[model samples]
Target: MEREQLIVKVCGMRDAANIESVAKLGVDMIGLIFCRTSPRYVSMVDSLAGFMPNYTVNQLKEMKNPSKSTDIKVAPKRVGVFIDEMPQTIITHVYNYRLDYVQLHGYENRIMIENLRRTIEPDIRRNVKFIKTLHVSTLEDVEEYKDYEGAVDMFLFDTSCRLGGGSGQKFNWDLLKQYSGETPFLLSGGIGPEDVDNIKNFNHPRFIGVDLNSRFEIKPALKNIDLLQEFIQSLRK
Candidate 1:
């Protein structure tokens, strides 16, 4: 049976080759993590886990500013992921990467979101979308952020854990039925290629998209492109 179109976002990306491969698939969004705590953090200097030399500032600049010989085919909109970062710092990365959307995966309250909205440059702000993350474990978790409907463009629902995200965990999607907020949301957490059937069966008016992460990874920060391609194809089928 045909299904409603859903936005596909492959987050926690680091490798340049992998990024290019994923981009060519024409996924809706490609996420690059900026939070240091997460294994998927994009950095210039090599880190302890050796995920660095990964997605440095200069590399992102080069990707956005393509050269004559190096024709980068960026099909998906780049989404920058942040966790409790200062407003100015987040703004800097947004401008640096020419990010199309900023996913706040931290404990940023309404005030912080408001500050970010006000502080970001007008031109960038106009085009860039703000996706606020609501870590959910219960119905109350979804209710707490109701006041942020106007502050953000979309809401991302992920499983709550000690670590920010990329926990490779799935929340009780049933709890989302209790969400009566006006804004649409993307379902995340432990989503993998196999879950396509579950996603197809899941029904929700505000279900606009799905955020794929750890479950699709080859290792921490590196994605299994083939698996992702299959999942995307299945979603469209």
Candidate 2:
């Protein structure tokens, strides 16, 4: 197997302390859940227990064009994870928060993905990349998403959970190795600190990243940064 850039993405981050730890670690991306139906939803006034100073979108925006050297450090490219949200609603957050990526985890068809892309094309400020996800129960499910290969910038194959993503249970890795597509994808599902060796052993050209969710969580919305740090460090080794 040839060595490739292994991207580590820490997902479902709720508060600031974990976010800062992840940012400082220089992971590729961090996901903030927007789906209210999911147990991992991070709402307004969510506790800042572990964070240095709490901030909202408007507050962060004011510091964006910092006049003082003490302006708050812009955190990792904020990624909003949505499932079945109205395109307009997604647009609102994307523009308001200056999001870097919109990860669609619902049953959004190819048309929806394209429409979302076209919706923000005229407005540079709202331009955000789309990452479509597919739930994998079998190798056939992986094959089913080929038509969408070119429609999305990246594909996230997560476990088939009752409520959709955030399930820490992993699917079959051998099935993923059989995937014959050109679209680069992230392997998600029940991935934990122990999965590092398994991932390193698996060989595939299109394997781009790993999505960590429940396995790295202390609770629904909180994360254990040490688990993530160990996992990431192991990848580097």
Candidate 3:
């Protein structure tokens, strides 16, 4: 986390205004959960008066490189977080939401990831990047990173627990030291405002960022912007 400009991905985002506010915070990415079982699910939202229905790629682009925003120059990159879903299902979401990244957060295989990647529209292919999640608890799980080496654009190492999707728990970070893979990754699971000191001290060659969720939320998908502002400012300091 001490590395200069380490990316910050604020995940499980739901509210429209809240998403915009967080984008103004200069976060690198904002993730919307697509898993039906997830409380932060986007389907119930986007079909109605939520983000996907109103927010479009042009609007997203404007948010990113806005000419008049004092808060941040670029908006947070949009990401669609999915479980083990069909390639066509993923394709529809990617096209509908205009996501910048797709976080595969289930027991997805390399073929599944590659197929989805290859199936995306040729024009949209360049704009989308895939992030595969590696739920870690022990050395055995960490070593599985190699199996996904050539499939994804990046890896997200989250905590392994029975209660999935925003399990507010942390795995032993020391386990990541054993990950000898080359793909850069975002450290997830149980990260909070309190981790600034620990995150600043933690260093890795391929470690690129952090994924904030349950720990920073006021409820299922509502984030405490004040707390996040303090955390980001303090961490960057």
* lDDT values for all models: 0.83, 0.78, 0.84
Q: Tens digits of per-residue lDDT for model 3 on 1-237? A: 235678999999888878877877888999999988887887754557756324445467567879744454566788999888888888888887777899999999998788777778475556588899989989999999889997888999999987565999999999988888899999999998999999888878998899999999999989999989999988777
Error at 121, model 3, angstroms: 4.9
lDDT of 2 by residue, 1-237 (tens): 458768777888877766766666667888888898888776655633433233455356566855633233444567789998999988887875567888998888898889888987668454577788889998888886776888888889898878798767888878887788888888898998888888888788888888888888888767787888888888878
User: What is the clash count for each candidate, in the order shown?
Assistant: 0, 2, 1
lDDT of 1: 0.83
Q: What does each candidate score in C-alpha RMSD?
A: 4.8, 4.4, 3.1
Candidate 3 at residue 161, lDDT? 83
Best by lDDT: 3
**To one decimal, what is the Cα RMSD in angstroms of model 3 from the true structure?**
3.1
Which lDDT tens digits does candidate 1 get at residues 69-178? 22234457788899889888899888867788999988889888887877784855556889999999988899976768888989999999998788989999999998
Task: Point out where model 2 deviates above 4 Å.
Answer: 47-75, 122-127
Residue pairs in candidate 2 whose N, alpha carbon or C atoms collide under 3 angstroms: 168-190, 169-190
Query: Which residue ranges in model 3 land beyond 4 Å of their true spot?
Result: 52-70, 121-125
